[model samples]
Target: MKKFALIFVVVLSLVLVGCGANSDKASNEKKEEAKTITFQSEDGKIEVPAKPKRVVVLSSYTGDLINLGVNIVGADSWSFDNANFKDALKDAKEVSEEDVEGIIALKPDLIIGSSTMKNKDKLKKVAPVVTFTYNKLNYLDQHIAVGKAVNKEKEATEWANDFEKRAEEAGNEIKAKIGENASVSVAESYDKQMYVFGDNWGRGTEVLYQAMKLKMPDSVKNSALEAGYYAISPEELGNYTGDYLVLSRQSSGDNSFMKTTAYQDIPAVKNNRVLEVESSKFYFNDATTLEYQLKTFEDFFLGK
Candidate 1:
């Protein structure tokens, strides 16, 4: 009787061990099943991680990703320059398309970049890659598209709706103060050339024209409306100055031309209607940037 009992006990122990092994295998399979999702890119559909823990952004969409609450492991150099992104990106490493080995070391789960990038083939080997055509979707749609990629569409939509309402109300109040026909122009001075922007270009152009429904100066419309921006000489700057001018220039840039008679004599300059913004701060059209633009315009127009 004792010998028979020992054999039965051994058999029961083996059965229990096998059950535990099967359970662990099943758990691992479930994790693999939940790993990825199908993302529709501008080019075509591709499989991407459903919940990307580490994302590397290679273009100007850094601010868009920041607002969507993605964990950025690596980003382009330009992202670091954004005032709004300073705190959020403090821990992130600066990387570009040129840094393939560096990006590999970071082990990003996903990558986002512009369609114009040249290293798509190499990046795909490291992880899933998705690219967006700039302005292919309008500024608001672009944010929504980003949310979709990161599984935060609802949050993105909510923010977009709120911004629209706030911008509309602000626009009405600003129009009342500045008059309906008062025009607004956004101009930027770079190293050697000056650029005038239209409704879609950054530098608060979207908030000023697209969201706030502000008027664009005819000279700006003719030169920059279709092309987004027009490069012109410094002497031509006065022609583009509207009743209100939003000027974007580097903080330490040479702006001595502002003292010249040609620049001072512009109607807007004479009236002190130019609102100077740091070029790097106003160069992007992302949620963080749009918020800054909205507040800046509100202060400039209504003194609020």
Candidate 2:
């Protein structure tokens, strides 16, 4: 009779242990379910971590993500190419939409990319993928959209407002020093092509024309404003010159045109009213680059 009681007690203990294990599993699953929330992406709603810890950027929103305090483990080549992003992305690996296996190895909690990225479906299978169409929203709105993706909309919005105010103030100061009617032109040369940009394009055009309310020459406005950028021959560069010229130049680019008589004869060039910005740094209009640009422009006009 005593032996039977001992066996029965052991069986009861095992049953209780099994029930507790099942209960703990269910509780864990419920907590996991509560940790994710649905985000209304550009295409449709998808679940994303409430606080993403490891993010992989497959697009140009690197500066935006950095500004919003996201921990990026991987990013595209273009982001790595941006000079201003060098220190910020020092620990990040160069990843692209084509790097499926590489990205998977990074163990990213979220992935942000462009709408036209080829590996969208494949990436989604590895992690939640969010994409944005370029220029679909203005720069500030784009930042806000990125913030929402990372669950930091309020911080993004606050930065946008503060940046706008500072830019406007700086523009007023610049206009006062350079004359409000003075026109400024932004141009850059890469490979065999020389191009002029409109207000929305990078190279400080957004800060100069949009945020600072600086003046753009009629010729550039007619050509680049609608199309974003217009290619011109090196000889025709002078045709787009304004009272002040912002030359977005790369250290290694074919700036041989600068030594040409046609370029030197331009009023802005002859008068030393040209501000040369590094192409890699100026190529992006994100918060990191924009702040550098704003200071550059201010010092160029307001100081020596």
**Estimated TM-score per prediction?**
0.88, 0.88
What would the per-residue lDDT of candidate 2 be over residues 142-183, giving only the tens digit for each residue? 999988988889999999999999999999988888898999
Question: Whole-model lDDT for model 1 versus the true structure?
Answer: 0.90
Q: Which ten residues in a row have the lowest lDDT in candidate 2?
A: 29-38
Q: Supply the TM-score for candidate 2.
A: 0.88
Residue-pair clashes per prediction, in order, are 0, 0
What are the RMSDs of all candidates, in order? Answer: 6.4, 7.9
TM-score of 1: 0.88
Highest-scoring model, TM-score: 1
